[model samples]
Target: MSKSLRTLLNEIAACRHCVDNPDGTSLPHDPNPVLRADKSARIAICGQAPGTRVHSSGVPFTDPSGDRLRDWMGVSEEQFYDVQRIAIIPMGFCFPGLDEKGGDLPPRRECARLWHARLFPHLTRLDLILLVGNYAQKWHLGKERKSTLTETVRNWRQYLEMREGPGYMPLPHPSWRNNSWIKKNSWFEKDVLPRLKVEIKKRL
Candidate 1:
């Protein structure tokens, strides 16, 4: 028999591989792995690792970016947070630390390598996975994704039409820094967000 989701979450919370056994330099700070999920959920939001604010708050998406994401999905805070309906899992469960310029580094490779294969199988009800940003898209879409983030996101319809397992929808990170990108990509707001909102409502 397989271990329960609760058991897997416990192991993830206590993980120290990034520190005790690092690929390069150990994590700059102690790990506080963060993620949310429930086996009944039909939707998953997979983004990059936590930023400074989220690391401090101990909650995923506790910032403006989260606000934007909620808006994109056309869901309120209460709906977005209900784990029974939606799961918020990042590529990295912890804050991977910042660079010299004060920007966050990429999500640790170990997270997916160690946990995703185990964790995802347990989310038996998942029907839609929203891959937020390049890292999530890269990992989830693999070779099927286009060369550029814009291209992959622009070609979003094909991903939704996928006949295999869960349907994937690629999205740009909701960070304010990408306000310019969002402005330039008018089609996303005009086309993709409407479809996203409909999907979210159907699942809810």
Candidate 2:
């Protein structure tokens, strides 16, 4: 890693807000809540918070969701993991504890507030940004998004229609919870996926 990136990694690894229940209390490990990026990357993938597996590994997208994401992007493990080609900065860097409804909780509010601007400048070569999940789309595309997550993703072509530099493309989170939504939104299967794969191929 470059000196700057290595320094940033040390800072992230040393964080302890949510991770250091040092008093042995009932609280959880919610450390620094977002990922950092290298300065020369070309493509950026923005997702939600880290899941349990990702947190444990200290590597972004190291779980099933990541597997599905690679498939959607038509890339292999090596390609996906290549920081020079792709950059991943989820909304939440640390694991966001858990939800009462049986899934991981939403990313902490403070993380995005603190890190996004810092991370954006480093991505000088970013050609495209794949905004995965509603949180990412809402924050990046804002009112340009459609009525719902499914609609917003289905209308991905609309964002592409903008044909601008920030070349934003909205996508559903690859988590299994979205299976039903994907089924209902077949246009995504018929239209978006193929186009997404094509764009990824072109960029990579």
Candidate 3:
């Protein structure tokens, strides 16, 4: 039989593959795999790898981006972090480090290859998964994903309407850097946020 979710999480917590084996270059810093996985949760906030702030905090979404994501979902801080209600599963469990431009590098490929397929199957109560950035959308949506993030997120309704499996909601990353994109995409607030709230409320 497969390992229990708790056991799997324990293994993941002590994971050193990124630094020991690695995908390409080992992580620049010591490995700090940051993610949350609770079997009781009904919704999973699927996001990219941890940034500097999250890496330091070790708690997921403890940054300004988190505040915006909470607003987008119309939930309070308490509601967002409730382990029984919401799960935070990012593409990469660790901080993949920064590029020369100072932007965070992409999520480590090792993370998904090693853990995602194994972990997701254990989340039996999950009703929805919010694909919260390009990396997440790409991995989860696969060949079905649209050519661009905007297109994938714009077609969010289709993913939610699926007859089988957890509903998927594509959302842009809520980083402060995306403020310009958010301003440009007025319909996201006018059209998407209402539906997102409705879905969240239903599951909670």
Candidate with maximal TM-score: 1
Going through the candidates in order, what is the number of backbone clashes in each? 0, 6, 0
> Roughly what TM-score does model 3 have, to 2 decimal places?
0.97
Q: How much lDDT does each candidate structure score?
A: 0.94, 0.78, 0.92
Q: Write the per-residue lDDT of candidate 3 for residues 2-88, one digit (tens) a residue.
A: 359879989999999989999689998999988887888999999999999999999899999999999999899999988788989
lDDT of 1: 0.94
lDDT of 2 at 184: 85
Q: Where is model 2 more than 4 Å wrong at Cα?
A: 1-9, 17-27, 30-36, 161-164
Q: Would you list the clashing residue pairs of candidate 1?
A: none
| Candidate 3 residue runs with Cα over 4 Å from true position | 1-3
Tens digit of per-residue lDDT, candidate 2, span 1-204: 477666766766665644443333323754744464766777899999888887777788888888999998999999888887888888867777786877887776555666676667657788789999988898888788887887788777778767666587899999898899889888887888898999888878
How far out, in Å, is residue 45 in model 3?
0.5
- 2 or 3, greater by TM-score: 3
- Give all TM-scores, in the order shown: 0.98, 0.87, 0.97
Ranking by lDDT: 1, 3, 2
Angstrom error of the Cα, residue 46, model 2: value is 0.4
- In candidate 3, position 83 carries an lDDT of 78
- List ranges where model 1 is wrong by over 4 Å: 1-3
Clashing pairs in 3: none
